[model samples]
Target: MNMALLPSMVAIPLGIAFFTYLLARKSSILADILGNLATFSILVISILLIKTRGVYVIGGWNPPIGINWVLDGLSNLVLVVVALISFAATIFSTRYMEQYTARYKYYSLFLLMVGGMNGVILTGDLFNLFVFLEVASVASYALVAFGCNHEELEASFKYLVLSSIGSTLVLFGVAFVYGATGYLNMASIGGIMATGNQNTILTVAAVLFIVGFCIKAALVPFHPWLPDAHPSAPAPISAMLSGVLIKALGVYALFRILFNVIGLNQLYGTLLIVLGLLSMTVGVFLAVGQWDFKRLLAYHSISQMGYVILGVGLGGYILATGGSSSVAALAILGGIFHLANHAVFKSLLFLSSGSIEYSTGTRQLKEMGGLISIMPVTRTTCSIASLSIAGVPPFNGFWSKLLIVIAAIQAGFHAVAGITILVSFITLISFLKVLRYAFLGELPEKLKNIKESPALMGVAQAILALFCIGMGLLLLPGPREFLLEPAVNALIQGVEYARIVLSGS
Candidate 1:
């Protein structure tokens, strides 16, 4: 396959989603087939792109002058993550969503979300990234309100209002950058900024980008929408929003602009570290007291994301201070690796919650007990995901957490390392509460008849459980070279990214 065909990986799905929406009322089966086929094809294309690294100029124009789509190590990794999770969610939704009406509309919105995430990851232009972010965010807001219940509508409206504010701030930042540098292309703007001295406009733009992304990422102060939004959505959509959406649209974009486009400095580094710590502490504290199964998991999402940002922020700080490259490399690797690992475990956790809700018809953790006896597959898979998220050994989360701790210590942030370890223990405690209340203990007499979820649900959860184990092998020398090294190098390269893209043009 020609490498240039990569952009179609996003365009095709978006086109089909509109078509699916038009035909939705006529034939629901067609919508399901189209949704599955589109996601699967994208997955295949992403795997192919992993082997071919280069830039694809959109509209036959090269970078610095025209829009381009770059497929490199970091992007290819995120693309694969998006593809795999979308495919699994589609399969789970096919059976799970039958309980609700209007299946075709659900599928259409789902595909639109997939397309928007692909565009966000692949786009080489800064303005284009903001456009795709809004596309995805709008779709998600509607999906959250799909139930139309009192709680669902309330959550969806809140999310839409906050998200609109965030997107507006991002646009405001983009306009300032364009006005100052006289360019919308990311590499071109970066090149111009690199040649000139710092000024008030660029500094203000940077601040806007940080605040805007922090809202999208659900960092401590901006997190009110996430807990409400995630639980109100139908289960599969919750999986998508929590699993990959926040990381791709928020964290990934922030890292790309801060490190690659603007050049990482001490101010940005300190800001990331402080926000990360605040989110980690506050999110977990809230999670521990929650009785709602999905809401607890949602709060943990914020806490885990804090770990990712902290690692990357530390890496940026060390690099700015002219410290050892090895320490910086480890910090970036831990952050990116955690991003991938969190996607897997968090999706699995949501899927398990969906299964429980499907069989038992409730999401209250306190109402459920001894589910393991009736729903064996769900019991086993949920246990694995819990262990993984709690940072137990031999699971994917353990290695990533260990790396972050080591990197923090190596960079002379002893207090940060201490806090990271303390947070891991708190995570373990929270999961134990979940296990005791929801899975273990006496089986409620009314719930004894509840059975396992459908075959497809089991298959999806099992695939993720297996991945939780297999991903540990990524730390081994051979796999590290193929998967981990490239992404780490991408961030470590920092401002040199502009030079490379401009050179290709």
Candidate 2:
């Protein structure tokens, strides 16, 4: 089909990143227009890719031997999510970033990060995946410190340090794989590994890979930098970090490697379950105590990520243990569904928090009160996002969470199912604290003169809020078979991806 659009995904934003920095140096408005145009164009392209699938071998070289850009059920699913969130974030930044100077600089780094993430998703080479992951990670490190204040710099430094360690571990894992298989292409490595040849070296590589990606995912003990770095960045950037970044770079990578490369197993499933449970319980519990709006949202990112990890892990456990195919598919579907839902609503939550801060000049929930009347758009959109994340019906989150719990029960993991319910309730408790202290009480005297966020900011939040409401329809028959089923099949197929990818190549 339209194979040209594949490379253009990475190329377009990358080209704009450089051009905006140089040519639009003096014009913040020009930078904003250029950035929005780039992301919006990509969003249009990504949507058109709804039913498209193919592998575009780079430079006309044979794949499994040369670098390739592949589009399939899994990567295509992620591409739409990335493009949608990036477009909305760009729109929000047009107004939200006026508080800071040098919009050109922000736009440049922002685009670079987007390009890198696109590269990470599309590339078929494991080494190139690492390269692209670093490209995005490095750019994010700078963006976190864009404020240049003591807090921002400190947060950035912590992120850089931990992120670099993750990178080093990834590189070591890559080296181990290359040494074992003599190839860097993911398909080739998977093909070689599927020969049922398990060894100590491979085991070491798997451990390194798991730990490295876990760090990137910010799972539990590895999540210190997230709470700090996320709150330190601007709201749109915060949206990107919590919404898509961790999923693309962390959860997505971990799944791709474990399921497709090293192969999923009982041990891997158990590990995922342990780590996911810890992240889920710890994140929501800690979030209940935070008064900082963005910080609270940041912790929820970890908790939501745990849901994704847990659901997928459950699916993997079922598959590895020879459980029912339908049940395994349901669990994986739940995880992937949550991944997409979280991307939109979490981004909206951050944008809404940005709107509130834009109006009230503060982030403390205690400092905000009765904003529903004054900033109705922000309050309404924010409430939608809150309920969506809390698993309210007719919203995307509820359907996915329902799938996860049902799958867990069907798979005979009653305790895991119960834990999922516990996490959901705890999440509600955390958000209730948010609603009570921020939107339900009396407006402070100082905030009475405050106004709502600008039109563009409201537009961004509204787009995501609508998705928060409408995403539940993805679970309906037609859309479910067309969209969600492909993703589930990709994971269910697992290492067979090597065969599908090679045949297409």
Candidate 3:
């Protein structure tokens, strides 16, 4: 547990963000170097900290009295995911972003978003979490509208309005929480509540938190903004938003506060399961009918995220009902494992879509054809991503989805298991449409001269694609013990998390 290294995770990207904007304003190349350097540095640090855990107090102050950053298993996992996706995004942007202006501004906002996510992950208190969430949200809104076109502006504005509403709800939730417990530190609040001292204000705050994060996660009824925002953003930004942003800010925050802070109950767990089912069914249905490339992928992001929520929600329900701990652990393992898996394949899919659009200048399926013969790297990588997302054998998605299904049945969630399989089948059908229309048909006459994407873009896609294939290896005994199990234990520990944090271990 190296406490000093925890601050570096948040500080490096934040410090470099302004420096990149100021010093590289005139040089896109310099901006590229700085952005990649920052993300890469964090990625390396994240891997190093995987075996490390501790609390880093700010300004030599102690817990409940001073602001702190805690690096436990859960935060470390998210930090690694954030750093990895941000690094790959920066790499992909070096070549793909040539079409956009003010490259330094783009990198600046990108790092700011990364920094905010790190802050959200590392913060030991609820107030700082909200602040970081807003930082990341604001940056993402600007990036979505970075193109400044009518569609981009319109989408960004809608994202802004809806996301602002969500944030306000969260602020109100925080206020109610503070009023009830008189503490902003999550462990302090959890400690007080753990003595069976729950009340109405806390309950209201819980509902508010759930609704706010559901909107941020874009679950079904709260998901109208994502279809527009994701398609309108540039490819790398889209990858970041779909891959890690929603998970870090929405799903991870929601579950952490519920399971660790206020405490999970049967009612909340059932509500989560309901939301997961609706998002899975509705999102995939809508996606299946879309002919636009990025739009379809956007809808599937909602559906895939539902898988994660379902798995974890099932585990929470089991725990709340006094079910077997081993079964609950299995359920949570599936959920968090899927979280990591989705970040890899979905990011790869978006990058592949970007490569196709870069060379073909179109996002409509009708406008694409026979890419396999020309864009070999894009084709192979996209095919691998497509198979993974569809939950085909030997790819990462299958194992996670399988784990969820087995956990559902083992927990007597037969209906939930059925819906999970149905949604996956529909997901496969939708992606197959992408493959048949976008890659397998005769090459459009307009695309004959189109070349493969640049070396950096391919490198980025290849990096994630390899993960899409290899992530299943994490399910094995050693990696699962070191990586996935710690995260599951963190969530399952519930109020014990407060004890650990308060003890500074």
Clash pairs of candidate 3? none
Give Cα-based local distance difference scores for all models: 0.88, 0.91, 0.92
Ranking by lDDT: 3, 2, 1
Model 2, 1-505: lDDT tens digits are 6877788899999999999999899888899999999999889888888788888899899866789877878888898999999999999999999999889999999999999999988888999999999999999999999989999999999999999999899999999998988889988888887788686777888888888888888989789989999999999999998999888899988998889888998999999998899999999998989999999999999999999999999999999999998999999999999999999999999999999998899999988889878988998898889888999888889999999999999999999999999989988888878877888889999998988889989999999999999999988899888688898887888788888889988
Candidate that would win on lDDT? 3
User: How do the residues 290-371 of candidate 1 rate in per-residue lDDT, one tens digit apiece?
Assistant: 9999999999999999999999998999998899999999998999999999999999999999999999999999899998
Q: Candidate 3 — which residues are off by over 4 angstroms?
A: none
TM-scores for every candidate against the unseen true structure: 0.98, 0.99, 0.99
Model 1 local distance difference test score: 0.88
> Model 2 off-target regions past 4 Å?
none
Cα deviation of 489, candidate 1, in Å? 1.1
- Backbone collisions counted per model: 0, 0, 0
| Shift of residue 381 alpha carbon in model 1, Å | 1.0
Model 1 — TM-score against the truth? Answer: 0.98
